[model samples]
Each structure stands twice: as C-alpha cells, then as structure tokens.
Target: FPQRYAHSLFVLRYRTLALKELQVASRKGARNLCSVLVKTIAEQVWAMEHPQYTESRKEPVDGSMVGIQMGKTKVFLRSRAFQQLESLRNAKMIDAAILVQSRMRVFIARSIYICVCSSI
Candidate 1:
C-alpha cells in the first residue's frame, strides 16, 4: 500500500518522499490531527500540571519532622491512588451514576471508605 513506508527503517531516500506524503496527509486533515494531538497533549499537560485527577493529594511527609521522608512527587506517584482506583473499577464500586457526582464529594467519600476498609 502507498500508505505504508517503503521500509520501516525510513532511509534518507525514502525519508524525503515519506515526509512529503506525511505532509500531504497531514495537510489534508490537519485540523483533525491537530485536534487529536492537541487533545492528547492537553491531557498530558493536565496530568503533569495536576497529577491528582483520579484522586486528591494526601498528606506529605515532612522531612524536617520525620525519621525518614520522601518527596511529594515520589509519594504521589507511588501512592495507591491508581491501584485503589483500579480495584474500585474492578469491584464495580461506582458505576455511571456515581461517576457524575461532584468531584470533591465523590473523592472524599470514596477515599475515606477505601482507607478504612483497607486498614482491616
């Protein structure tokens, strides 16, 4: 197919024409592609700017007052937030109805319940 690159390695000879075709394809649906890529980038940016989309940030360890302390980023990323969310999803704890609730309320209620339940 013309759509496929002649070679996966993309040699220089093919690079020019390949780039030209990509440019043509990109131009044909630049708006759509831009919208998609822009959406992806926006989501990534949002995730980067606020890593707590699925959950809120928990209390961070204070380095000055602790025997051992970890940076917020380390704690945030390593937090059980994702795993807990995955389990909630697997357990079907919240279907579509609960998903529409106010973000803060939902998070607070769900997190408290999860924390209490997990402790047992």
Candidate 2:
C-alpha cells in the first residue's frame, strides 16, 4: 500500500541520517553521544513503525501533528521549540523557514487531497 511505502521511505531516510550522525560522533570521539543518538533514533524508528492503536486515542496527537491551514494552504505558526530546532539544524546559515513552511504546506495539502480522493 501507499502508506506502507511512504513509511518505509521515511524510515530509510531517518536511518541514513542517524547513521551519518553516528559516524560523526564516533569520529569526534564522543562515544556517549553516539550511543545516546543511536538509542534515540532506534526508539523513534520503532515508534513510527509500530504505532499504537487505541479507542481512547484523540485527534491532534502530541509531537506528531504539524499545523497547516487547509483553505489558505499555509503553515500555522510553529512552536518555539520547533523554531529553535530548525535554526540549530541549519547552523544559522540561512533563514529558510518560509521555504520549509511552504514545502510543508504543499506536502500536507497533497496528503489530504490523496486521502480525500482515495476515500471517495
């Protein structure tokens, strides 16, 4: 199924990134950092692969939801933590939040459109 394929790609991409980070940590002689990063990455990948299903589950699950306007097709303002992480990840090289937000908006919109079309 398309969902399964998408999930696989997501896992692959993250796994590749994690491996690269691990290598960097090792080269920097930060054994503790490498160990912690690998553990966290493994946990995240497992969580994504085996999502919990429960009747008590509510909409807009924490950490998983990325807000975007449906009609206007824009990203809702991100939290402070997200902004900080984005900046940190980019090494302050450029403030590309607008570009990233636009991409997120388009991706979210396209996903919604696909789900709507598929269910019809």
Candidate 3:
C-alpha cells in the first residue's frame, strides 16, 4: 500500500519526466520535459525540508542542524550524485500522508505550513 502510494506521488512528482523518458520524441516535447526537471528539482528541495515523519516514539530524523556532515567522492571520498540522491531519498517524502480527505484538511495543512514558514 505504501509503495503504491509512493509510486503515485512519484508519478505526480515527475509525471512529465517519466512521460518524457518513455514518450517524448521531439524538440517541442523536450520543452515540457524541462518543466518536469524544474518541478522535480523544486519538489526535491521541498521534500527535503519536510521529510517523512511518524507519530511513533522511534528515533526521528534529526530535527537539528547539529552533527551535520556532507561530502563528495574524491581520492578518498564519494560520488556527488550518490550523495545527492541519498539526501533526496531521505528528504523527499512522497508517502507521508496515510489518509487524505476533504478540502478542509488540505486547507488547514497548507495554512499551518504557511504559518510555520512565516514564523521563520
């Protein structure tokens, strides 16, 4: 169930990319492909900020900026792409919501998000 929900969100997240990778075939088609690239990027960043969380008491994704560490592949390091993908996977939450219903829920969610952001 979670996997299917994630796939749907991924489809939504990169609907154009998945389409382009499978169907896009011309210069005009490529234009829309760019939109997917851009949106995927933006969503990736947004998802990073709002990662998957649960109501359980298990250890959560650290909510602090401490112990932060990042690096790339070098003579003794790692690949940049690999690191970025890892970060995105850890951040881009595509199936965080288990149940979604009604416009009011949507409105309140968005409102809270905005309120939190404004506070920052």
Writing each residue's lDDT as its tens digit, candidate 2 over 1-120 gives: 111112223333233435556555555543344333434443443344346743344442332232211112112223542343344345433445767888999999999999999999
Go through the candidates in order and give each one's C-alpha lDDT: 0.36, 0.41, 0.38
Compared with the true structure, model 1 gives a TM-score of 0.23
Return the TM-score for candidate 2, rounded to 2 decimals: 0.25
Instruction: Output the lDDT of residue 40, model 2.
Output: 42
Q: In model 3, state the lDDT of residue 119.
A: 100
Off by over 4 Å in 3: 1-28, 52-120
Clashing pairs counted in every model: 0, 0, 2
lDDT (C-alpha) at residue 57 in model 2: 42
Model 3 TM-score, all chains together: 0.24
- Indicate whether candidate 1 or candidate 2 has the larger lDDT: 2
Off by over 4 Å in 1: 1-28, 54-120
Q: Over 4 Å off in model 2, which ranges? A: 1-29, 53-120
By the TM-score metric, which is better: model 2 or model 3? 2
Order of quality (lDDT): 2, 3, 1
**Largest lDDT belongs to which candidate?**
2
